[model samples]
Structure formats: C-alpha cells, structure tokens
Target chain A: MTVDTAPDTQSQIHWFLIGMRGLFSLPAIILMLSFVGFAAFTAEANIPVDQVMFMTGMVWALPAKVILVGSMLSGAHVATAFIAVTLSSVRMMPMVAALIPEIRDRRTPTWLLLIISHFVAITAWVFAMEKVRDVPRYGRVAFFAGFGITLTVTNIILVGLVYGAVSSFPPIVSGCLFFLTPVYFLTSIWISARHRVIYWALGIGLALGYLFAVIAPEYDILLAGIIGGTLAWWGEKRLRQKEAGQ
Target chain B: MSFDGVWPYIYIAIAGWLATDIWRWAGVIAGKRIDENYETLNWVRAVATALVAAVIAKLIFFPTGALENSPLWLRLGSILFGALCFFIGGRFRQPLGIAAAIAFLAAGLALIGL
Candidate 1:
C-alpha cells in the first residue's frame, strides 16, 4: 500500500493543527511551569535576596542561576560569579545550534533574533523543537513568540509567588515542585527515544555517574555526559551499519 | 545579606541574558547554511540529546536534598515505574500520561517515606 503524502499546503494546515494540539496539552503546560518554578526556587535559595527576584524574572535556567547565586552567596567577586555562571552556560551552545534551524527565517530581523536568543532556555528550546517542529517554517516565529511569552510570564509570576510565599508554603510542596523539574526532563527523554541503545546509554550513564560521584563529587556530570554520550554514539553507529548490511 | 540593592542584580541579570543570547544568535546564523539531515548534525544532535539524558537520569537516580534523603529502593522503584509509564505512554502516543506517571511515582515515594 502506497502511503498518501498530502500536498504541502495541506501538510502545513495539518502542522498547525498539531501545534494547537500541543498548545493545550497538560504535559506541555506543566513542564513549562515546572521549569519556571525550579528556576525561581533555585534563584531564591542561592541568589542574594536583592538579586533573587530579578534573576528569577530573567535568567532562563536553574544551573546558571544556581552558579550565579552560589558564587554570590559565597562572597565571591562579582567577576568570579559571572565567570562561573558563564561557564555553566557553556552547554547552551550545542542546545542553541540544535534549535536555531527550527526558528530562523531569511527575513527574520537582527533585533528579533537577539530577543529570541535571549529568551530561548533549555526548556523552551526543547518545547519549541518537539511542539513546533511540524509548524510551517513561516509560522514558527509566531508560534515561538506565543510560546516564549507565555513561559516568560509564567516564570515571572511563579518566581514572585515563591519569593512572597516561601514562608507559608509547605516544605513537601516546594520540594515536589523542584523535584518535578528533573522528573519532567527524565520522562521526556524516556518518551522521545527511538533507538534502544539510547536507553542503554542513559541507564549505564546514570549508574556510572552516581557511583563515581560518591567517590569524587566533582566532575560527575562531565564524566557521565562525555563517557555516556561517546558510548551511545559509537554503539548506535555500529547498530545502524549492521542493520544496513542485513 | 547587605547586598539588598536591586540595581546590581538587574545589571547582572541583564548581562547574563545578553551573554546567553549571543549563542542563540550565532546558532541562527550558522543554521541557515547547515543541512539538518547531514550526518554531522545528526551526530551532534545525538550527542546533545545523550548529554541531556545523562543529566536527567543522574538527577532522578542520585538526587539531592529531599530526594537524596529518601530511601534508595524507593528512588529506583519510582524511576523504574516512571520509565514504565513513559513506555506505555509513548506506545499509545500520550505524553501527558508519561508526565502523570512521573508525578505519581514521585508523590508516591514522598508519601510512603521510602
């Protein structure tokens, strides 16, 4: 049976439909909110009280916020904290590379590009890739603008709430919110995998990283990603070649 | 605690935001010339995805703070249960169900004290 490939116009219409489908999905909304809540809490705990509110409003990721706040809390020099936070953000380079093709257009303005660059965090990037991939290239900017604005507003509000309500909130509730950030990430990865070896890589990587961290706390993430990623790449290549030969 | 002023924080936040934006702009410039299905890009995507996966797995399995305090078996069980949920959810093409599974596993762990 020949598969029916719809015309490009029809396909574009279908893409918009899928985008709308994801727009109202519960997981999409929760994942978006959880990312903001985690960033807010991290900022609150680590950032100086003065910086906490503002960073939560702007800084996109928890790791960068953690580094920024942690360094400042330790009374490190401002330059030192900046350097630390920037170093933590080195991972963003690859993430940006992966996301750019999904959003960029020939006519896209430089200033708009600047705003997008500033606004695209890891959570936003992943959401854009998964939810907006099928969106017509011409419509992606609007989709991103809509999605990014919602996330930004949600983050600002959540940070404000956490900042103002921390004293009254139960410990478990706050903890759960924090916990959901990683949980959401883990579940998303688990759901998105199309290859079996990727699963093996994640499983082995976690075990090795955790054990090594117990022995040497520093470099756990570096070791895990480098070692696990390399192994998965190699294994996947070999598996694909074997299938081709068959 | 003395650094209670907001100006310094705003300056830092603005600076951080700008610094991160640099990478995004560069990606946009570079993306125009690159082929998405190119083998090199595919490998890059794989590596990036794997790195993220490694980090997420470490967070769930090793954990910290309240999660670290929870019993080891509970953590492992919750993750396994969550993975199973992810599997079932994906099989049926339901992302929300997978998220629900994770939330359920975490809440269950918290309530059971293990």
Candidate 2:
C-alpha cells in the first residue's frame, strides 16, 4: 500500500488503491475526528446509535446530518427538516458539478457517476478535486470511489463506536468532543473562503442566526441563511458596480 | 406523528438522504451543461456558506445536546479564541486553531467545575 508506482497499468483497481491510500491523509483524519464529535452529539441528543450510523452513511454530509439531528431535537416538523437539509446540502451541487466533468469522459457511465456523486461532500470533494487532475480519466471514478467508500465506512464505524463509548465518558470529555465540530467548521470555512463576500456572508449569517433563533427558532437557520447570504451577494454586486463606475 | 424508535430513521431517510442526494443527482445531470465558474455559482456558494455558518452558529449558541452543559461564555469564548489563533497563526494553522479550541473548551469546562 505504501508503494506509488507509475501508471504503467491504468487499471481501475490500481487507481482505486491509490485513492484508498488517502485513508491516512490529513483531511481524512480530521474528518474522522469531526465524526467523533458528531457521534458524541447524537448520543447526547439521545438518538439511537444505529440511527446515527445510518444517518452518517446515508446523509453523508456533516452539515446536513447536523441539521437533521438539530431539527429532530428541536422538534421541528419533518417538512421543515427536509427543507433545511435540502438547503444545506445544496453546497454539494457545485462540488459535484465541478468534479464530475473532470473525472468523467465518454467512457464513464451516468449511473457510475451518480454513485460517485454520493461521496462528494467537503473532504472528499476537496481531496478528489485536488488529486483527480492527475488521475487518468478512466480511473478517476474508481479512485474517488475507493476513497469515498473507505472514508464513509470508516466514519460510520467511528460514529458507532464513539456513540456507544461516549456514554461512559465524563461530561468534560463529552463537552470537548462537542466542542470539536463547531471549531472545525468555523476555521475550515474561514480558511477555505474564496472571496470577500463569503466573510460578509459568514458574519451576517452568524448575527442573523442569533436573532432568528430568538424570534423564530425553528426557522432560524433557513431565514438567516437566505436573508444573510442574499444580502452579502447583493452587497458584493453593488460594490463591484460602484468600483466599475469609479 | 410519533417520536419513537425507527420513525426517526424513516424521516432521516427521506429528509436527510433524499434531500441531500437530490443536489448531487442534479449536479451530475447538470455537470456537462454548466460551467463550474458560471456567475450564479457565486451566489450559490454564498448561500451555501451562509447556511453552513448558520449551522455553526446554532451549534455554538443554541446546542441541544451535551454541549449545552457548558456555559455560554465557554462556548462563545473558545470559538473566538480559536478564530483568533487561526488568524494569528496564518495559513496552515487550522490544526493549531482546532487544538487551541479543544484545549480552551476542556480547560474552561474543568475550571468551571464541570
């Protein structure tokens, strides 16, 4: 597994092996740590561990999983949960759209691409997008699938173990576990922010989230996100126009 | 209409799995048609970022689980401290920032007699 031979043979399995090697990558390790946090969260929320495992593999995205659990705990209606998860998961669209073409060519099947798309959340997306360019077109899907399947299965097992183990842990331990996730997201989002507008969106979203939680707790995430994001985008557009005029 | 065993899984399947996967399905369908750098993609990115930020805010300010055990100050302070570290340490310090946050939280929880 430690060997990195050249692509004399472009077998899908060879590329898949290369992808599986990312199991030890920094992003994968960080993701596992985050899932440990998520597992602790689900345990604290009193969600069944099996269900947490299910959601981990099925929902796939951390944010969407959090929203689902949050919505459930907050007693939001099912429809509301659906909508929030949908909105949160919309981020995957651009990632999938961007990566599919890079990895796919005339030989790739739509069904296979669809299967691969399930693994296109943040960590895998970042990893695949960064590495796929080096992969031959025929093997990119296998490479991504190898990484994706390994990552997902590893996380599902991690969450299950953590959820079961968190019960015996002290409050301080669980508290620290809970603390890892938000910090991870905040720093990662800040670091990965591509443009100035994202900062505006983040600030506005945080501020408006607090306000909406007070006024309309169930809809806080939705309302704050739409209004704040729109405002940020609109502000950026206006600023660009003003600069153009000047 | 119930909040019992297995029901939540069903809801999650529909609301969580279906809701999330639809976007990926759409992306695969639309991948060939749209440029990744299309202008509207920026707005989509903004909204997505905002949504994720909103989720983070909710987790910090109004968590429902064991995280609620800690005081609001600890929750708020640790995040601020982490962000501070992130900025000061420059790029490639995300691990440092996260480690700082976990330490802050653990120390805060211990000091407060949790």
Candidate 3:
C-alpha cells in the first residue's frame, strides 16, 4: 500500500494532488460555507460582486477582508481602512513564520517559498501544519500550493456566485449566513491555539474590545489587540516564572 | 489616488495585498534565519492571536450590516453555546461548533419572529 505512493512522492504533482485532497477536509468545507456568508455580507453592503471577488482573492484572510469591507462601508478614510486591515492581518506573519520551516527544504528557492507563503491564512495554515510533516520534505511547497491555490481560487468563485444569488435571500437567512464567519473564527482559533496564553488574549481582547468600542470606536480593534496582547504576554511570562521558581 | 469611483477598488487590491502579504514575505525572510520555536515568535503569536480575538469579539458585539439586526442576547448566547460545545465536540469540534452556533442563531431568530 505504502509502496505505490512512495515512488511518486518525489514528483511535486503527486504531492500537490495529495494536498488538493485536503479541500474536502472538515475545515475546508466549513471555510467554504463561511465564505458564502462573507459573500452575502458584501452583497448587503452594496459592494460590486467583482470587487468582492477581487478583495477575497487579494486579501485572502477573512478577518482582514471583513475589516476592509466594514471600514469601507462605514465611510472610513482610506488611511484608516489601510491601518485596520494591516492590523487585522498581522497574524499572518506568525502563521507564515511557524509554517515555513515545516515545508521548506534547503534547495527550495526563496521566491517559491514566498509564493507558497501567500497562501498561509488560518484554515490552510492549520491544514498544512497538520499534514505537512507527513509529506516528504521536497514536496511540501507543491503540497501547500496545491491546497492554498485551490482554496483561494475556489473561494473567489464561490463569493462571486454567492454574491449574485444572495441578493434574493431573505435578510434573516443572510444574517444567519453572516453569523457563521464569527462562529468559525472563534472555534477554529480555539482549536488551533498552541498555548494557554491564547485564552488570556481572547478574554482580555474581548473585554477591552467592548470597552474600546465605547470610548474610541475607530481605534478599538487595534488598541484592544496591542494592549490586550501585551498584557497577556507579560502576564503569562510572570506565571511561567512563578512555576519555574517553585 | 482620489477616493472616487475606481479608487476604492484599487485601494482594496493594493492595500489588502500589501497588508497581508508583507508579513508572509517577512516570515519567509526571517524563517530562514531563526528557529520556528524562538521565544520572540511567541510574543508575536500572542499579539496576533489577540488581534484576531479582538476582531472576532468586535464582529459579535458591534457588528455592522445584517448581523446588526439580531438581538445582542441572541448573538451572545449563541456564541457562548458554540464556544462551550467547541470543547465537548472533541474530534468533530469545528463542524459541531459551527453547526451548533448556526442552529442556535436560526432558532433564536425564529423564536423572536424574525
């Protein structure tokens, strides 16, 4: 059984196919549904479907896309939208940082790795991280690109289709659809979290997000993240020291 | 450069790509030199995770567009239920948590005659 696939493992296309198979995985399926919800969201905002598709493809990260659309819709200045989007997507750095080492071999070119890095959003990151170690070292790039490309292209098309069709959807239905994105975000983040500090971050971020929204609605997300995240990091460091000292 | 007709689209494309991809590029550059488990990466991860959490919380609490129509209690309750089940669902947590939240949303909407 293992013998048949072993020979082909060296071929990037073979590993790419293996990665594409992950499109049917549970997270991928849920992410597809979440994108459908995202499409309905852009529709309600009166954004052109083409623009929605473009943003989905370009931004790729759902949260950043949401902040972009939300800020744009609210008539936020271009600079504000830019900063909010940048802040929202800063997480991609860590995700790519963590995932790159797993997939890169010595001979892998930086350019090729950079292209693969473009695809490292939450779902694909989680999926690739979980599966990459099982892949032969050289094929990891193709394997990740296969899944990432397929996912990005599929979502771009999915958003276009859903945006067109969702115009006819009842407000209640679309609202329910929109709700899936947050639920997916919450649960998936919880599941993918590698450290206890995430719980602290989540709790503090949530509380401060609400507080900041009241006091300074414009900078709420950025402020909450920076302040809450630093506090959580510092607090966790203290806890670690206490345990080590004992 | 104007905030006129084609400008927002251009902005979305350029800004969106840069905002997200710059980090990926940085990761590739930095990843080459350092251990993935480097302590500094943890602080970066913590900040990133916190930022995302803030985004999620904001979506639920100060939602714009259609989700703004749902009552606060319904939104809050449904998400809490979903979060709780996220733990209990174990192997099927992602789907179960998602399904659980959507179901609660639909049910809550229907109950309130929405």
Candidate 4:
C-alpha cells in the first residue's frame, strides 16, 4: 500500500485560521494604535495620506515609515529620504534572518517564502516567533503568513480611518498620538528582550545616540548604530568567551 | 527632488522596493542555505537591535514637530513613567506603557495650552 502523505486542504485552512487570530491579538492592537497615530502625523504634517498607504503596504517596517514621513515633511529630497529610510530598515535583514529559520521548511513553497519575507517586522515577527513554536512545523509558515498579512490589512484600514478623521481631533491629541509610535517601539524593545546583553547594548546605544544627536544630528542614527552596536557586539563576545572559559 | 509629479511614485516604488525588499530577499535566500545558528547572524541582530535603540533615542532627544516643541523634562518624565508601568505588571505591559507615555505627553500638551 502506498503512503498518502499530503497537506490536506482542511488542515491547512484550520491552521491558517489559527494564525489569522493574530489580527486581534495584543500586539496587533498596539500596532493599530501606532498606525492610527501615524495617520494623524501625516495628516497634520501635510504629508500625503496616500504615501502612508504606500509605506504601510510596501514598506512594512515602522521605523522606516516614520523616517520617510518625517524626512519628507522636512523637505528632504526623495533620494535623501529613500537613503535614510533604507538605512534604518537595514535591521530588517537581520530580523528576517532570525525569523525565517523558525518557519522555513522543505514543504514551504519558494513563492510563499518570498511573499512571507515581506511580512516580517518586529511586531508580527516577535508575535509569530512566540506562537510558531506551538504550531506543527509544516504549518508554521502558513500560520505566520495568516497572522502577518491580516495584521497588515488591519493596520492599513486603521490608517485610512484615522487619516480621514484626523482633522476632527484636536492638535494636542494628534501630537500625543504621534508620540505613541516611538514609545510603542521603545517599550517593545524592553519587553521583548530576553537577555542582559541586549539591555547593556541598548543603554550604550541610547547614550551614544544622544551624544551624536547633539554633535551631528544629521548622522546621529548612523553613528550611534555603528558605534553602539560594535560595542555591544564586543560585550556579547566577551560574555560568551567568559562563559566558554568557565 | 520634491514629490512633484508621477515620477515620485515611480521613484518610491523602485528605489524603496530595492532598498527594503533587497534585505528581505537576502534573508530568504540565505535562510535557505545557512543554519539558523550562524554566528554572523548574531552580528546582524546586534546591529538591528542598536539601530532601533538609536531610532528611539533620536525620537526622544532630537525630536521634531510637535514633539520638538515639548519640554525636555516632560519627555523624559513620560518615558520614565511608561517604563515604570511596563515593569509593574505582566499582562498588558506594552499597551500600558504606551498608554502611560501618551497620557504623560497629552498632559504636557494640555499644560502648554495645546
């Protein structure tokens, strides 16, 4: 008798639905608040709402979107904005590297893998990473796809709603909402971390980043990342060496 | 140049896609070939971590627009309070921290007469 082994349609659908539940998960809610705030920022700053939509869908990275919108609002050329946004999002490559390992398998199609790569971000990536461990290995990619894609759609809708209603909200409220984006990312950084090394790195990075901001605001982000990350990397290495030596 | 015509969208689509998606595709191709535990990947993660750290610090210290107008102590106070909320409880910590930060800033806005 031949063994009939295939991904049954119902089972796949079942797992996909399980993943789709991420749309309303805690992280998703936080992301929605940030997106709504982003819409308000764009509305108030005279940034075209359509660009927000474009960044929401095409560039799923939040920090990049923030940089893009902020730079453009400051009258930076499109090329300069692109460079800053791109450099900021370079982190996503490592993010994807960390996440792809959790879901990739022989059964996951190449096309699916390509498409799902677009969905990786700090919010969805961390949430999916935590949840993927619970899913059957074969279905994990599908699960991430379901969770991530739905979250994006939800964010896009929230952006539209908030942008349309932004004029009604007081300028103070819009200002408060804008602050939420950075705080959301900042809070998540502290919350999601699992080690002291990261804390040390972030501490040094923040200090160095602030110093650089005072000295050379134009290259603050770049200099802080390189100098601080290199130091953190050195710290992590020393820790590892110590552990191995002991 | 300024976003003056249809060329802006075209530029965004092409340059933005290449800028962001290139790394993603690199991850896809590399993930297929390398072990998840590759050491160099750690360097990548560390860099990513520090990048976010820098971005957040920039927002707090070198802010622009509405954020720029706010008093420095107010911003620091907001983050401090938000961190306090995050560590105070387990569930809803992220949202709670976020809410605290927003409320703190909102209060600042009110004090300054919006």
Off by over 4 Å in 2: A1-18, A40-51, A63-109, A122-144, A244-246, B1-12, B30-32
User: In candidate 2, how many clashes are counted?
Assistant: 0
Error of 1 at B59 (Å): 2.1
Candidate 1 RMSD to the correct structure: 5.0
Candidate 4, A24-140: lDDT as tens digits:
776787778767767776787665667667778888777677776676667677677778777766667666766677787667776788888998877886686567777777778
| Tens digit per residue, CA lDDT, model 2, B34-98 | 54555565666566567667777887988655678668998888888887887788765888888
Q: What's model 3's lDDT at A91?
A: 66
Model 4: runs farther than 4 Å from truth?
A1-8, A45-51, A70-81, B1-5, B33-38
Give the per-residue lDDT of model 1 (tens digit) for A75-124: 77666666666655655655666666667656657566557666666566
| Docking band of candidate 2 | medium
Q: List the residue pairs that clash in candidate 1.
A: none
Please give the distance, in angstroms, between residue B12's alpha carbon in candidate 3 and its true position after superposition.
3.6
For residues B1-114, write the lDDT of model 3, one tens digit per residue.
Answer: 233588878789766878888988987887776555556666656666676677777878977666787799999999888878877988888788888888998899888887
Chain B TM-score for candidate 1: 0.64
| A19-62 per-residue lDDT for model 2 (tens digits) | 99999976788788778877767787788888889999998998
TM-score of each: 0.77, 0.77, 0.83, 0.84
Candidate 3, backbone clash total: 0
Q: lDDT of all predictions, in order shown?
A: 0.59, 0.79, 0.78, 0.74
Better of 1 and 4 by TM-score: 4
Reference contacts reproduced by model 3: 0.65
Candidate 3 lDDT by residue in tens digits, A195-229? 88877887888888888888988677778877888
